[model samples]
Target: MKLTLRTVGVFTLCLLLTACSLPRGAGIEQEITAGANDADADFAMYPVTRDFLPTLAEWPVVGEPELNWITASAGARTQIINPGDVVAITIWDSNDNSLLAAPGQRAVNLEEMRVAANGTIFMPYIGDTRISGLTPQAARARLQSELEAIVPSAQVQLAMAAGMHSSVDLVGGVNAPGTYPMPDQSYSVLSLISQGGGVSGALRNPQIRLMRHGQLYGTSIARLYSEPHLDTRLVGGDRVIVEEDRRYFLSLGAAGIQDQHAFPQDVVTALDAMSIIGGVSSSRADPEGILILREYPASALRTGQRGPRQERVVFTLDLTTSDGLFSARNFRIQSGDLVLATESPVSSVQTVFSLFGSAFGLVNAVTN
Candidate 1:
């Protein structure tokens, strides 16, 4: 019996000695954070809590480019004549002999008269008349006033059709993307999108980009929906494009699903990211050691409280505490971030004990 006990003890001791070499799916919490305590560590570590939320909030927005959005503005309700527009004019003269019409003819039809670059159209008896910025009705009235000097009884009727300068282009991510003519000055981005059959449903967090006069403006569809004031009016020659959001973050270590997750909404909180990754592995993850790793630009490491202490930062979250849980709900996750669920130290200990049990059983079998 003493010999058997001695053999079992020796086997267990040997297993204990080699326990540090045990294979693990992820590093233990302490092992990953051990270097953080060194004076000259390469990265700076921060504990995410309610008290730290303010400091994190003050940091510069990273990951995505800062894009500006145009606000909605009121415009004329009627279509205005532009340089490329084609105008058709008709003159009705009741006089015996009219300069615009023949002696027997009571009316004259002037068709396919295109507006020139100088915002003018040539007319018989009258010189170049500027009507580019005038509404269709206003331009007709102006033409009538000009013709009255030559023929007092002449009544002018005008019709204008939109040209390339009076239309907007819906580039992509819509059911029907093409050049849509602006029926009136009130035509807006949302109006154009609705005419194009709305944004595609297959897109994940779609983004709207407007290119006008060599400048580009961008915003998300969700923002345009939530804030009606942001559905900006579209100008002629503007090109609008709808595309899927390309921002994503990575999940590794003891997480439930190790994969890259796209931002489902405009702002993804840390808690939202955790849900996106399908939560951590319950068996191996430490509830108090969720770490988020991010790298900031070198310029973001300026000497101030508004910036990060180092270019490489490790943000720690303790889901075991209520404060940590609530803070994570408000903490924002930037693009290209890595969320790591550190393995529990206790899990490695459990594995060692299981191995020891198997070794002791082997020793008993040999002794028997």
Candidate 2:
């Protein structure tokens, strides 16, 4: 029994010696050390302070333009027409043998005419009459006046046919993506998406991007639905694209679950993100040592910023304190950020003693 006890003591001593001999990685102090070699320092470590909170808050806001779907859908349809449109004319002549009327015919069907480059069309009596920019009703009134003298008591009816000139495209991530024509100018963004069969349910975090007049604008469909005004109006030559959102952040160290998670909404606070991964491990996490690793552009750093003049940045917080808890509630989490909850020092000591207890118990069992 005495020899077995001595053996267990020797085994425990060896574990302590081995643990102390391992090399330690650089800490927050090394990152903030001034006059240090840039080759040795990889990033800047910042303590969570009231002054530094604004920097993190600015990261998640990308400044998006708001588009009102209600205003876009409520407007009266425009009467302006464009090229490549077909027009049909009908005339009721009182007598036959006229240039536009046939023999013994009370009504004459005029040949369909396509508008030319000058937005004009030719007729029997009227020469080069422009009708491209006018509506069917307006064009009929204008043309009737031109033929009143030549064909007395002649009534005119006009119909304009729509072409592919007024269409919006639905591209990618949709169940039935295609070009949908807007015969009526009251087509809203949601109306176009509904026609394209809407976004696919298989896609995670689908985004709706609109390209209009050579400029690209976009937002999440979930967001667009939440805010009715964001649905906007879709005009001709507008391209709507639906795709999966790729923005994400990583959780590491003593977190309850270590994995990469995508942003669920347009804005997410640091406190909200901790709730997302089930919070930190209760037994192993050090509540006072919550650290957020991030990288920012050097150009974005303010003149009086307390960090290095480089892009790499780190932010540390102590959740045990009231200040940290409130600041974290307001601090925003940006994409590609790394949220780490450090392991408690007491847990490390407890683990070492646990191994010693196991060794001693095994030796006693063998001796008995």
Candidate 3:
């Protein structure tokens, strides 16, 4: 028993000493100031800082793709009369001499007159009157003036009969995806999404896309909710799309949870991201070895940089200090980031000693 105790004690002492000189895992710390001797480790290493965090956040988040817009007007174009639209014009003569009257009819029914390509609808006595750019009320006034020459006391009433051309499309990832008509010319983007029973899954992170005239604009649902003004009005023939955000980052190594996690919010800071994934494993992780691996466009690093630029960049944080804590809080976590919590050398040394101590205890018991 004394021999076993001595062997275990000496083995543990040696491991504790080796802990100081133990090797570290892959990170920016090693190569940040490395000489030309290190060739394989090629990447720009950035230490987390108050000023640098904002620059990292400046890294652009992707927007939706482009599409064609029928209403090319800025800031959610208002609906207007278009060709192929159907309008109903009713004509009433103040007296029995209504120019629009049929045999024994008291009024003339110009039902469902399709607007011709020339942007006008035909009226009974007044041939073709342009109404494509005019509202229903405006069109009525236009017809009344034209017929005043023939039927000086003619009253004209106009209203749209067909709505197939003036509607918003609810497409992809919506609970009730279909075509819904605009309530008025001022129907908004949010109102259209709400009409489809809201978005699927968490409304916070779902992508919202607005496509018009081959031009595409989009943002996260959370962003749209935060900035109410960004939820611009919708026009006829505009398509509003709500879809799931597929952006995610991987947590590996000594993290408490090793998995791929999609960001819950539109903007996720590094500190919050770490907490969401259960943080680093207290026993196995090196607090000073927290590393974030990212890829940047080669052109981004080429500007104002002295050395040859590389696409792969490594950002290291030493959470053991107060400066790092604040820096991490402000640092933004980009999509597709690989967050790695490296193993501590002390823990590795402790593991070896633990196994040896167990073997020694077993041998001592057997000998007895």
Candidate ranking (lDDT, best to worst)? 1, 3, 2
Better of 2 and 3 by TM-score: 3
Using lDDT as the measure, the top candidate is 1
Candidate 1 has its poorest 10 consecutive residues by lDDT at 1-10
Superior by TM-score: candidate 1 or candidate 3: 1
- What order do you get sorting by TM-score, best first? 1, 3, 2
Candidate 3 lDDT tens digits, 77-102: 33467777788877877566565675
Residue pairs in steric clash, candidate 1?
Answer: none
Q: Which stretches in model 3 have alpha-carbon errors above 4 Å?
A: 1-40, 54-80, 93-99, 161-165, 201-204, 305-308, 359-368
For model 1, residues 170-199, the per-residue Cα lDDT tens digits are 988999999999999889999999999999
**Model 3: per-residue Cα lDDT at residue 210:** 86
After TM-score superposition, the amount by which residue 357's alpha carbon in candidate 3 deviates from its true location, in angstroms, is 2.8
Residue ranges of candidate 1 with Cα displaced over 4 Å = 1-6, 93-96, 102-109
> Total backbone clashes of model 3?
8
